[model samples]
Target: MYFTFLGTGAGVPAKLRNTASMVLTMPEYQGDAWMFDCGEATQHQILHTSVKLSKIKKIFITHLHGDHIYGLPGVLGSRSFQGGDDQLTVFGPKGIKDFIEMSLSISSTYLKYPLEIIEIDEDGVIYEDKYFKVSAKELEHGITCYGYRIEEKDQPGTLLVDRLKAEGIMPGPIYREFKEKAAVTLPNGRTLNSSDYIGPDKKGRKIAVLGDTRICQAAVDLAEGVDVLIHESTFSHGMEEKAYDYFHSTSSQAAQTAKAANAAALILTHISSRFQEDDHLLLEEAREIFSPVYLAKDFWTYKID
Candidate 1:
C-alpha cells in the first residue's frame, strides 16, 4: 500500500499546489487505487504519475466543498471515453449523490461503467469485504464533514513450511487445501489440523484520512493506532484564531490528534493556500510536535514497506 498526493493545497490553487486530492494504492488488490477528494483538474495531476483511471475503484470525499469535488465530473466523464469499464464506488458526506447525478445529467455525459455513490453519515463501518473495510466518523467541521478509517482485514496465518515438510506434504494443491482449513489425512493415518500448522494471524494495516475540521476527540478516536494518518493542517500554530474562525485545524492541533492516536506516521495535507510561500515552515511546525510528520505536496508519493 502507498499514498500519492495528487494535490495538497486547500480552497484555491497555488503555483506550487493544486487542491485536495490523494490516491491510495493497494498493490495486493491488482493495483487498485482509491482517491480522496478530487479537486479541480485532478485528472491532470494523474498525468505525472503511473495512476490509471481504470485502477481507481473508489473515491472518498471529505465534504461538499468545491475544492474537494470540482474535479469529479470531469474525471468520471473522461474515464468513460478513456476505456474504463470497471465499477466506480464513491463515498462521501450527504449531497454527494445529488451533486454527481446533477453534474452528469446536466452535461448529458454517459458513463461506460457502473457509477455508485454512497452518502456517508455518523461514525461506523461504511465499506467491508474480504480484503478491506472502510469506516467513517463525524468530525467537528462547521458542516457535516467526516473522517475515514481504512483498515485492511486481518490475513490468515502463514503456513508452516517446515511443519508441512515434516509431515511429508509438498507444495501443491494439497497445500492450498491445508491453508484453506480443508481436512487433510497424513500418511500415518493421522489428520493434520490446519490450525496447528498455521502461524499467528497477521494484523492488517490501518490508515486514517480526516477532512477539514477543528481539533476534536472524535478525530483521535477514529484514527486510533493507525499505521498512517493523513490529516488536514490548514493553518499554522500561531493562526489558531483563524483556524477556529474558519472551522479548520492548525499544525499543532493536527499533530496532537496524531499523537493521541499513536499513529505511526503523519502526512499533513489540505494545506491552506495562505502558507504557500512558507510550505516548509508549516511542515516544520507540525514536525516539532510530531516526530514522523510529513507535509504533503502535489504528486508526492510515499510507499509503505
Candidate 2:
C-alpha cells in the first residue's frame, strides 16, 4: 500500500496548495484506493494525477470543516458520472451522513452506485476484513473529530524452497500443503515440519491519519508506534499562542506528538496560507524534534514498506 497527498493546504486554498485530501492506494491488498478528507477542489486535483475515481472503495472524513469536506458532493456526483458503479463506503463523524445527504439532495444528484455512509459515534474497531483492520479515537478539536489507525494483517514469511529441495523434496502441489501446515508426509511416508523451513513472520505496516486538533494524548494513542503518522501542522514555530487560539497545532507541537508516540515517521500537513512562499520553515522546525519528520506537499507520494 502507498499514500498520495492530493492537497495539503490549511483552511483556504493558496497558489501553491489546495486543501486536505489524500489517497491510500492498495491495489494488491484491496483492489482499490481509500481516500481521506476530500477538501474543496479535490476532484480538480485528482485530474492531474493517476488516481481513478472508480477505484475509490472507501472515504474517511476527519471532521466536518468546510476545507475538509466541501468536495464530497462533486466527487460523489462525478464518480457516478464517470461510470463508476462499484460499492462505496464512507466513514466519518456523527453529522457526516446528514451533510452528504443534504448536499446531494440540494443538488438533485443521483448515484448509480450503492453508497454506505457510516456515522461514527464511539471509538473502536470501525472496519475489519481478511487483510486489514481499522480503529478510530476521538481527538481534541473544535468539533467532534477523530483519528484513524489502519493496520494491515501480518503476512506469512517466505518458504525455504532451497532447504526443502536439499532434503529431497521436489517443488509441486505438495509444497503448497507444506507451506500451510506444520507437517507434510511425503509419498515415501516421510514427514517434515514447515516451521523448520520457514523464515520469520513478516510484520505488517500501521498508519495513523489524524484531523485538525491541538496537541493531545489521544493523538499519541492513535499514532502509537505506527509506521507512518500523518498529522496537521497549521502554524510554524513560535506561533504556539496563535495555534492554540485557532485550535490548531504548530510544527513543534506536531513533532512532539510524533516523538512522544514513538512513530517511525511523521508527515506534517495542513500548512497555513501565510507560509505559502516559505513552506520549508515548517519542515525544518518539525525536523528539529523528530529526525524522520516530513512536510507534505500537494501531489506528493509516500510509499509505505
What candidate 2 gets wrong by more than 4 Å, as runs, is none
lDDT of 2: 0.93
The 10-residue segment with the lowest total lDDT in model 2: 23-32
- The positional error of residue 165 in candidate 1, measured at the CA in angstroms, is 2.2
Q: Write the per-residue lDDT of candidate 2 for residues 51-136, one digit (tens) a residue.
A: 89999999999999999999999999999999999899999999999999999999999999999999999999999998789999
**TM-score winner:** 2
Instruction: State each model's CA lDDT, in order.
Output: 0.90, 0.93
Cα RMSD, model 1: 1.5
Query: What residue pairs clash in candidate 2, if any at all?
Result: none
127-209: candidate 1 lDDT, tens digit per residue:
99998999999998878999999989899888998998987788888788788865777667888778888899989999999
Query: Candidate 2, 31: how far from true, in Å?
Result: 4.2
TM-score of 2: 0.96
